[model samples]
Target: MENFDEQFSITKTVEFIQKNKSTRVILQLPPKLLQFSSKIEKHLKKALKNDKISFFILAGASTRHCCVDTVSSARVFGDLIVHYGHSCLSSTAQIPILNIFIPTKISIQNIISAFETEFSTQKTKQMILFYSTEVENSISGLYLQLNKTFPNLKRTLLNLPKNEKEKVKKFEQKQEQEQEQEQEQEQEQEQEKEQEQEKEQEKEKAKEEEKEQEKEKEKEKEKEKEKEKENLKIFGRVLPITDITQLSKNQLIWLGSSTNPTLFSLALTFGAENFLVLDPEKEYLEFEKMERMQPMRRILMKRYALIEKAKKSENIGIVVGTTNPKKDLQIVKYLQLLIKNSKKKSQVISMGVVKSLKLGNFVHDLDLFVVIGCNESLILDQSDYYRPVLVPDELDLALNHDREWDGTINLNFYPNHDMIANLEKKLKQSFDLILIEQQNQKQIENLIISRSETRSFKGLETRLGENKVTKIEEGLSGRASQYQDEIDLN
Candidate 1:
């Protein structure tokens, strides 16, 4: 009755147990911690070594059935209750109750090292440490002493209440918030950097546009100067004739045909002793030898060689004929490959008949011929008592058609005389030439351009490469038309 609760304090409890020589110490513990309980019991017993202090190790079924009344009964029977590894719930006896919070297991050394690393690197100004009572008692004092040594580092030791589940939940919530805030800040910085890059790109684009505008203006001025120079030369020169040697050596003209004797003679007149006939057709090759003098034949053995030859030629031009338009076009293309290979120096001239000179029912004379050399040839096609003049107007009109569209006429099969005549008239009007040499310069240009566009064949033998042109049977029944259609679509 005289302040019995005062003795329940940890100091008094220890003192009272020591005084009683025959005190029965009952050690009650959780089943999970039975091993810890036995170790603690052995340690305590050794500390109070007098055999007068009786020890009863309650375990198994006895430990499972333990309650406050059972514990109180032990106290009434002159025993002191010492609960191990469990929080104290209630005490009914006036005898002292010692709640010894001995750890179930020791904290691993690795876990201590991990804690130290985490605490040192944490961005937060303050951090807290939490542990069970046993762990606190073992390490809290050491941690406090260390904190004093590093005064900048502060720590809070969470000495939780009997039930500390809620405190743990709150600590977890705070840690999650800190991590989320750090992540958001990092994301914001990345977005800002991306926006800055986009702004720099826009500035670069604006500068490029300004530079492009300046370049375009300079190109226009140069083009106008060239056009004026060309007009002045035309005014100074004599009229174009069958032979153009009278013109300046540097002056260039597009002769449209390799099959004409006049064109061949014109080449000789212009000091062109060498002939580079691009005629691939057997018929045109023979016709050139018979009609004109035996001129040197220039054949493209490989697409690459053609480029080199065209580049080296002094007066380069394309010569096309309407007699066999398709074959003529092939030659035109060969010349084009030469010109394109020659780089940009070679000029092209296309020549064709202005009208078909029909000789009765079976024979027709090819009045058109393109002479692409250094000069224009003087010879003209004769019909009985009249010599027909080759008109530039006709040539211009044909060239316009060739330039505008694929003038792929099969003159071997589908020679439309009226269409040819119309083309000639249009060219005559356009160029203001009364008797213009009929030529399709654009067709020859296209040939060169097409061959130039072809990719260079790698590791191919020279002779085999020359036959790169896809051949089809000479009739409409062949699949050449379909192949051409496919090419056009592409």
Candidate 2:
């Protein structure tokens, strides 16, 4: 339904394939975008007509649609991949990818009017701008324009690849260097003679500069580590932002689809009061009503209730909702260890996508389920579930008696050092208590045998309680429907 030529740069994709000299290219699209595959393929083939080049369109991803399908590309022997639709901008280790962000048109004037109407009263409050990745191409235009009117406004930017203009400049520079290669060679001799003359004079200065550079490099390494600690990666998108911790205090202006799940995740992470949704498609700003945020707050309440329910549970089912085992395996094992230390039984189950019906089969076996997956998959609607479901954070709160709830929800499954330390202490205590109980049972058994020594003179009759023999009777042998008790009168 959407125009491929306007929204996506098919020329850029063609240039990328040509640059890479890729014989086999993979075009990975989400399910919604599959219908446009023929049109996309036709355009690509018309633009690039190389006999050796072959194109393959992967209908859907192996895992979540937001994630890049690297495994599929490898299966198809693809050298380059062009991903369509919305992406989390997650870094992939296997293959190089070009993400095509779908852009939607929005009136800058309308947005400014909405902003003024909402924030005209409070001019001092700083706001953070967040938009879905689909509208990323428009965000630069929106951000630059919005900052002209509101000087204090700040927006988080993704670390994107080089633009077409930069690429063109680099290509031109390479061509210019090739053209001037003979001239540069002629000047190289002159430059070498000048370099030799200055080398002796600058030798001592160069050593001192190198030492200072080493010291500065060390300082930079420390700074980078600190930066790494500050950066937060949620739902696979890495946000190198500082204001995220202060989100509860600051106002958030969300620009994207109203039905985006990330919007709800953000609201649940921070309070809903600070959120203002500006839907470009709907062409309105939703802030004053606050009715839309009610469902997210309700989700928070539901998750909290599930935590309480999880605390009382005896058998916990740790559901692995991610296909990537390396990322979630440690989390699953850690949860199991924590539940075990709490004196509860835990079982690890793997499912690509967790469903109510699949989990319902274990309704009789499991008391509650703790899902270990990405941030997007962790928040599930459990209204249809017979048993309650929880994320790793809730599971941690439920199992750990030493820790208290901080009234904040974190969807990231990575546990910190403090939690690990607390779990170790609890484990030691549980083991000590278990050993004490075992010793007490052994002592009670010895005491029972000692007490029975003087009162067992009556032999087997004392323990058996004087059994009496009785005659056996024939048992009824008929179907349940024609049982003796239910027979009709004859």
Candidate 3:
């Protein structure tokens, strides 16, 4: 609630409604900030007391700004959507979106001390102030004092341009989602039949299967709910930028931590030599830049190696990672078209979250799989599947032979018109060469599989259907402190 700017938000929302002649609006806040919806609505109603403006709160919580509530806005027929807390994505929505940036708890004194402590000894002039939602509170003070001392200090504000699309893809995606849900229900019903014991108790057996399927569905829903939770604990603290961008800017000092969506976007988008750590919590400011992001840099190498393997691939599977109605379907379509042009067989699979076990079933049919989703969530840990799972960016690099290695992966492929258009053109061009390559590669597929090690899951013969006892390293002592206050001797 500390980050909620009630006065400012209410005023702005009222003004916007009046100017646009809007009667209804939907409020979309991050899960962390959702509790303040009632208070915000109250203030809004009081302000527009005379007018009959209806305000609806979006029940579906979002993790990142990329998860725009297109469904709510469209379904409600809302004139505008007031998105709060997170920084904006470079996405054009069907409805007008008002992004309200609320400042974190970091004070001006803390920010000033961070700057002074970092540059007390040395003369560091070329420094950039990178900030997100925490702008209104800390920025004015930093600017007031710093500008007087230094002449040219640059600030990179991560604000998105307002570009509303004429056609909204929400309705179309919703239809596809409904059809998929129906298909899933049918498949689950079929699986229940195999799991049942006898036909004598058919109705009872069907009920049991329904209960089992419901339990599985409940688990999946819980997993998705956990995924949407924001790490609100990471906010307000300043953190170092680990990326090495090609931007000519000298030093980058980001104001927000990794929790802020803009921090990652700017770090990946901009090119700087070294990022100075000027966190408010630290007593001494880190003047020296941290070590280069070697792990991330290695992703480039992985991309190159994967591309080589994909070149000799005979079949491809397109895996859509997200079940959300607002996910991009164009990327899947384009990948299918690309593989088709190469004369390779391709299949599209909608897997909510890519699991190695689920994908292993298609290992024989598919030689390679391309995952379409968020860059962070696209690739899974260890990647234990038989076929290589690559994101859209990785797949794009692997398939297209005519593009320079930029060494940057866009998390959300938006607002990059040039890249998207060129990729389409390259994929649609004459495919005689690619088709020939695939034909030749088909001969080597069997040889590659024969050399690969087959993976297996085995049950312990001694303890079948038994719960194995877990080793407690600390035992009672560790748990005592955890529940000391709750336990009473009486």
Candidate 4:
């Protein structure tokens, strides 16, 4: 509530809503900011008088507070969502969102002074400056000051897309995609007509030429694919540095709250050695003298152990953490298929937030759970879950019987054609070995029949002898807050 007007642009939001003519708006606030929800809603309502707009303050988000709760908004038929607090700036949401990032105050001079004090004697060639979204406004100023003070050190700022620009670009990209699809349809029709006309005249020569051209194109495509695979293996949302292969050599300077989870994820992604944190609001250095290496090492060791355990898992559960209808859903389907082909039973379950309590119910059924979520959500504590939870890359490595572990961990849950093909190849190799083994055994059919007979099917006997059934009854309708069945005492 402090500096509410300066921190949150109520006027701009109102004007934008009026311009867009959004009737239903969902205001999503984090747990910490929930106290101010009523105040914010009242101000917005007062400003938008006679606009006939409804504001819904959504609490208890299913996903991380930083990520937009598009699923909840969609449930209420909200046309627009105004998200408060820190944000991951994920562009995968299905609805329009306005992110109002919390601003943190910090003195640029203090950060410069801290940097000078820490590395006064240590000679560092390159440094990568990472900042949280809360302190993004001050990052540029700090970068400028640091550049002026330390001219010898090569500095790089982790550049993410601007909030407004990212949304606009997403809209433009969608429009462009639609236009391209229409153009492709027209081109296909024209090409079909031309092909019909030419089919009778020079059929033999045209067929031969087309075959040769197709072969050349395939060869070129294969070459390009190989090159791309060799050059780019890095995926995930946390792309701090350009050449991530050389990340070990550079010093990492983080500008934001010390408690932010992103810092931990970055530390896990890269090594935590030579990492510094500057709390912008407090204007002081954290972890300056403390030991971060040991904690990071423990995390890596636990994750490595989990990966090893995941290989022996029989019943795997693919946990979808985000509401992304495209990428996350595709990953869930692909993972299920991959596990099935690998001769392991797998199940897909969707959740807004994955917790130990929620997963405890499935502990008896699943041996391990593979989490497909945002970069931050991928890093779960070892003690949190009863069973081992592995990321997509970790699961991929576990299922891969031949690949050797080189102490590299990837948090990429995005859909990649190469990853799928590689896993499929490994599964096929295993299947071939199984086939050879089956050929050597004469009682394969009998063994399969015995295993099938042991399975239980109680559904066929659960029905009662009587054919008459009860009449269908109406259920609760509308939103949970105001169900149709609730009686009005007033």
Candidate 5:
């Protein structure tokens, strides 16, 4: 109950501990491995035989690399931290951290045999292999062997495509171009010269040149579109999006697990049928396609609805919740510029941690709140709080026409200099999907709360928000005069 059944390099951990000679170290692990922290603590203590050196286990809720415990470790005066259960991010931590992911050992020969048997029947035109960094070693040989044996398989990473504003701008440009083409045609039709025969010959030559030029322009536009469809850039290593064109419409792309919620969200956004999961942890190599991506569609719908609400908001509050102020100052300035551009009143607010009770204190002063999260995304469960709390990217979705939500519903607002101009980020999974799962967990009591129950759509009644496909809850729709539909709401 207190030790992990999984095998890892115990000697390496011992070497790290010995080399550091850490007097006070913290071990942070995901929930499943949290129970085993105590056993790990004892083992480390016994191996070093240094009673003076202490090992403390973190007791905070940590799910992924995004929500790192560096701040938590610092608060506890931890000298070092040993993180477990996920691949380490390239971003440096505030303190030294040793990432010990859950390692699964399987033979390359056995894995390929399973792969040949299970994956041979797939009618996929092309194959690409991706491995999560944590278990890269477990499946790396397979990747190489597949390359040598199959030779046709490609190695690639996913690139996230363009945002909404880019599409809109292109559309406007095309419209202007078409208008110019019509004007040119009208000008060509006019005959100013009295030499009718020579004018006709000259006009025909000009028309032929115009047609050739138009054909060339069309070809150039097509080439540009193809390039755009292939090039997509993504942030950090987690769930970077890919241009769907570079990916085959008829191919089966396989991803190795260390797959978590972020990958799940990405799989849905990228088109589930186009991708498959190759989990080496499973006894047999079974690649399966994700069938459900509707949750992402729902999240997109809710976020866009929120974007509409933010556009009309008069009293806006910016919640600054980052641990690093120096790096985040620009984001604050950016928010101020955006708010100024929108011509709305704004007040900056900060609480060490954002909670409903704290946010409720400003209910009278603010109509909408934008939370500034640098590393960890702040997702306020509005199960109790009524006012909408949005992150910076959602604000861009509302006020800035140049910036658009790429359906990357991620709440974390780390201002990468490159992404500053284009806020192209997505969620690990829809917050609604998370809430839906939470509601499902409470079903033993026969109570199931819908994800749509938390958000109020009063602000979404405008034409901009009218693309909504989901229905409003019956209670909120003024179905009954007394609002008798209310029975233990939330």
Candidate 6:
């Protein structure tokens, strides 16, 4: 050999080191450059044949100038320092430091091939290569060569490393300092603008307040005029129920002396022309002369007539009612006689409180009854009829009854010597019944007027009064407190 260096190229350094066994190749590279560590390791391993050869990679931030201090430290520790990506090193590093420079062309090819392999596509039709502006010219030259090799591809150049986010952050901080000074200068101007706007807003607010006061004064004047008109009307008019029978056809009327003011207001608002005062002392026929009747009673009377017509003409009528078993049985007998006396076209049916009528148990078709309860009770008693339903209590008791009957009841307690008028007023907000020591003449008259209006007799059975569905004692004690305690424990 001319000399050892002349005979063997430095490329064979890995093989020479491997031949000596116990050789350790410690690679020191920039932290960012270590992204190629896997490829570097693979290439070095391929160049060495000895099984005893060892490799160590040390990465840090100072590799831009090939960190001399780290190289010396590695050498003192008996490890060969292979500094990658740099062509020079500091003179103070006494250790043997190998400088390796990746060929620019080779680097470009490697990068492109790596990207193609990762993305699984051969089409590099449009690409933009970015690098530090200081190195942009070099990369641009490489891009030109690549374009020649790949004629179908298009390339765009960008200066990137210097424009990276961290680099731009420093520039932004400097600009922000300048902006702060400018903002200080503008602060006085902005404060003056805000104060001027606020003064204008206050002036507008004062104007609006003045306008509102004037509007309120106008509203008061209008209210006084309305009050005067109402007083005049009240003095000129008569009570609605006094001569209700003399009212014209299709005329609306309100009954009852103790009618709710709110209800009266609602009726007037909804359009009622007249009101009819009822007298309980008056007979049913006498009230009919006045053409004034209770709503529920009117429904019952119409239903009764329909039932009778069906029996006389269509030979079909259903009787549905809840009554004492004895009374119900007698009513059914009377209905049977009426049905038998009619023509063959007439059919009479009845269901009593028997509770079990098999084929005849529930009669849905009906003519009339003295005491009919509800739609469900009627359906249960007479499943065969299709007639207009009539109920006592305007179906109030029927609708409000619990699905399952319980035994709890209500007892009315009043102070001593309470009049019916007073008691009725008190109970009006709560209960349906009026409890008093002695009923007033007007109140009794209203009650009788209400009863005569009834075409069917249905009332709450006091024997089986109010009942409780839920037991109070069964509820948990301080359930919410217990929940909070459990949460605190957790």
Highest lDDT: which candidate?
A: 2
lDDT of 1: 0.39
Which scores greater on lDDT, model 1 or model 4? 4
Best by TM-score: 2
- Per residue, candidate 5 scores C-alpha lDDT tens digits across 142-211 of 6778666565566544221122223344455667778966865665578445456765676798789879
Q: Name the TM-score of candidate 2.
A: 0.73
lDDT of 6 by residue, 91-209 (tens): 22333445454432224444444444433453443332212212222455555665664444433222111112332344555676688557655764778665777656756886798
Encode model 2's per-residue lDDT on 205-291: one tens digit a residue: 657876896798689779968876787556544453665666665677788876786766666666666678888776455454333
**lDDT comparison, 4 vs 5, better candidate:** 4
Go through the candidates in order and give the clash count of each.
Answer: 34, 0, 3, 0, 10, 27
| C-alpha lDDT values of all predictions | 0.39, 0.72, 0.60, 0.72, 0.61, 0.38
Put down candidate 1 lDDT per residue, 220-298, tens digits, no spaces: 7799676545432111122322232333422222112344333343343332332223232222221122123442223
Total clashes in model 6, counting residue pairs 3 or more apart in sequence or in different chains? 27
Flag clash pairs in model 2: none
In terms of lDDT, the poorest run of 10 residues in model 2 is 159-168
Candidate 1 wrongly placed segments (more than 4 Å)? 1-16, 19-22, 32-51, 60-79, 88-94, 104-113, 119-124, 145-490
Give the least accurate 10-residue stretch of model 4, judged by summed lDDT: 231-240
Model 2 regions lying over 4 Å from their true place = 1-3, 18-24, 77-80, 90-92, 159-226, 236-244, 284-293, 378-380, 383-386, 402-408, 440-490
